[model samples]
Target: MTHVSTRPLEQSEFDIWQQAIARQFADAQVAAGLWTEEEALDRAVEANRTLLPDGLDTRHMILLRGVLADGTPIGRLWIGLTHPRGVAGCAYLYDIEVDPGFRGRGLGRALLAAAEATARDHGATHLELNVFGDNPTAIGLYSTAGFEVVTQQMRKRLS
Candidate 1:
């Protein structure tokens, strides 16, 4: 396994990350009964648009690609700083995905470490994210990476 490197997301990689993020959200929404597949897809697309990185603000949002020794992109991690007040900042772990072929290779952990480093560099005091209850694998990964569940969003169908 090669060391994962972090870099600012390029325009060319935006669509790929966007699609991956949309898929993640869509899956979660469907599992949570918040939306049907079609509805979830639509909402994910919109959310992707809203979260697209902007360069104007000093708010740093980075997308990191984890590459194999030969440089094949096996995973991706991203972070967005929501607030930066003095030396303390708040950030969201926007996306973290390991390609199907790359699972079980510890690349996910590597990507997370990179994200944490990025957060520290940006003066972030805490990093946060929402994980679906169904995604135990992700929950475990996040837990191991030093995230605690501050709150859980529960839903009941009114229909």
Candidate 2:
């Protein structure tokens, strides 16, 4: 694995990151059957905006961009305290992704490590995240990273 590092997301990169994250999240929701194609984008945008009310300056939010030793962007991570003032000692991983072109290079695991460190620095004793049931790769990654399933939701579609 290459030496992957994380840095604060630059202001100039926010728009591109926001757009891509929203689109990817929307697609995932649609794939999981939790959203419709027509409304997914709107919902995604609103949900993100709601969580990131101050964008990069949002309280308790930690947004970082992962890069290789050469400074090439490979991925991004978003994490935050689950409660105000760190009362819960828990952090929620809102998002993490490796660029399609950069996948399978172990960057994802590096980003996860970065997230854990950042969350810990912010007073989080535990970290949690929600992955869609359809994302087996993410599930496997988290599982192998020592994450366990706390609960699950199941659905059966009928036509």
Candidate 3:
């Protein structure tokens, strides 16, 4: 069996993770129709800045690096404590990524499991996230991980 573990994001690696996070937010927002590609890029920068004013030290957010038993870094995961609208206590998966070189291995599944354990430790009873509608791969993964659609939005482009 392979062993996967997570560690708190080190100060030295925060810069790289921050850049990747910006990209993820922009891409996800564009996919979800919440913003155009350009607008997503602009707003991603602004939103991330606000959410992570102190970088990894930001309150209510947990950032971790995924590594193999031998200490080979393979991915990053971001989880946050959030209360969306009527929901009172929940953990939101802000981001999760497996390095390009490490893709297709089940690292993502491991990361999600880690997120749940960490969230529980923080007193979160529910978990939530927003994934781009078009990404069936991610949707399927989340579904198998026990996440179901609580709400859905649809849009039509008109000529």
Candidate 4:
């Protein structure tokens, strides 16, 4: 497995990271049938703004950038150290991404491990994430990483 070093996101990287996250999230929502193509980006932008009001310094939020040993950037990870009700020892993974060119090299799994370690360092005993059903690759990665399904939702179109 390739080794990836993690570091706090730099100020200069914020715009690119935010744009990538917004676009990817909007695309995911559209693919999951949860949002219309025309509205997905706008909705994603608003949601991100609300979730990250303090940007890179959002309370209880961890935003990390992954790079290779030689300092080549690979991806990013976003995690919330606390749940909505102030649940103890719980962390929520909001997002993880590897540059398309870097996929399939175990970087995703590496990022997951990093995320877990980071959460644990912050006193998290459990980590949770939501992966859209359309993303089977992520589902498989999370499953292989010992994550079990806590809940699932199903829907059908009558059209």
Candidate 5:
């Protein structure tokens, strides 16, 4: 197994990473029947538009690219600081996606460990992430990483 390095994303890497994330979310939407292909595409387009502009500020909302020993990009992780009350120094684990070809090789675990270390270095006592109930793999990963659900949020879309 090769070691992975986390580095802030460059402006040139935004399009590639955005497309990758859009594809992943599209697949998830299709699998969950949450949207049709057209809907997924529209949503993806909007999402890309929203995120691509923020690539310039790689400090507060940092985007980290995970690279293999030989410098091949294998995954992406986003860590953001929280501003919610009573949650000082809290960090949000935004998006974590490992390339399909690199799944089940402990890359996800390594990426998460890196995120936790970053949070700790930033003076955070706790990290939080929102995982869909259907995403058992993510839930398992978070559980193994010592994160437990402090509360459950239920929502109903009225649209």
Candidate 6:
């Protein structure tokens, strides 16, 4: 079995990751009908500012880098505590990504375990995250990792 571990994300890399996440999250919100493109972008910016008031120095968020046993960084996982992006109180997995080269090696699964452990450490009974419906791979992974759907929204475009 391959072993994995988590460490605090370094500021240099976190900056790049944060910007990308905010934009992507905004896009996802638009796709899900949670907000219009402009609204989603504005909300994403506001949310990031509120949660990371001090940028990488914010204490309310936990930004972690997943590494292999030899100390190679494979991915990053962002979890929000003070401001759960998914639900009011439950810790939210704002973003998690395994390097393209590191995918399919069970690293993603390891991160889920680490996230659950971290959530539990913070007294949360469950962790919530939002995955775009089009990403079947992620949906399957989360399902196998013991995550169940809380609710869903569907749309039928009438021609």
lDDT of 1 by residue, 1-159 (tens): 347766555567766667777887888888888889878988988876666645322246676776666777777777777642322467788778878987887888887777787877877888877788888898999998889987788766688
Ranking by TM-score: 4, 2, 3, 6, 1, 5
Model 1 TM: 0.81
For candidate 3, lDDT tens digit of each residue in 49-111? 888888888888888998998999988888888754537788888888888998788888887
Off by over 4 Å in 5: 26-53, 83-86, 154-159
In order, candidate lDDTs are 0.74, 0.88, 0.83, 0.91, 0.77, 0.83
lDDT (C-alpha) at residue 11 in model 3? 90
Q: By the lDDT metric, which is better: model 2 or model 6?
A: 2
CA error at residue 127 for candidate 4, angstroms: 0.6
Whichever of 1 and 6 has more TM-score, that candidate is 6
Quote the lDDT for 136 in model 6.
94
Query: How far is 83's C-alpha from truth in model 5 (Å)?
Result: 4.9
Cα shift from native, residue 56, model 4 (Å): 0.8
Where does candidate 2 clash, by residue pair? none
TM-score of 6: 0.84
For candidate 2, write residues 28-70 as lDDT tens digits.
Answer: 9999888999999999999999989999998878888999889
Q: Cα deviation in Å at residue 138, candidate 1?
A: 1.0
Top TM-score prediction, candidate number:
4
Residue lDDT tens for model 5, 1-159: 346888877767766777777887777777666779878967976875664454647445668889887888888888776633447778887788788899999999888888888778777788888787779999999998899898896656688
Q: Can you list the residue pairs that collide in candidate 6?
A: none
Report the lDDT tens digits of candidate 4 across residue range 1-159.
788879999978987889988999999999999899999999999999999999999998999998899999899999999875566788999988898999999999988898999999998999999999988899999999999998899999899
How many clashes does the backbone of model 3 have? 0
lDDT tens per residue, model 6, 28-105: 888777799868877997888887898777876788999998899999888877545445568888888988999999
User: In angstroms, what RMSD does candidate 2 have relative to the true structure?
Assistant: 2.1
Best by lDDT: 4
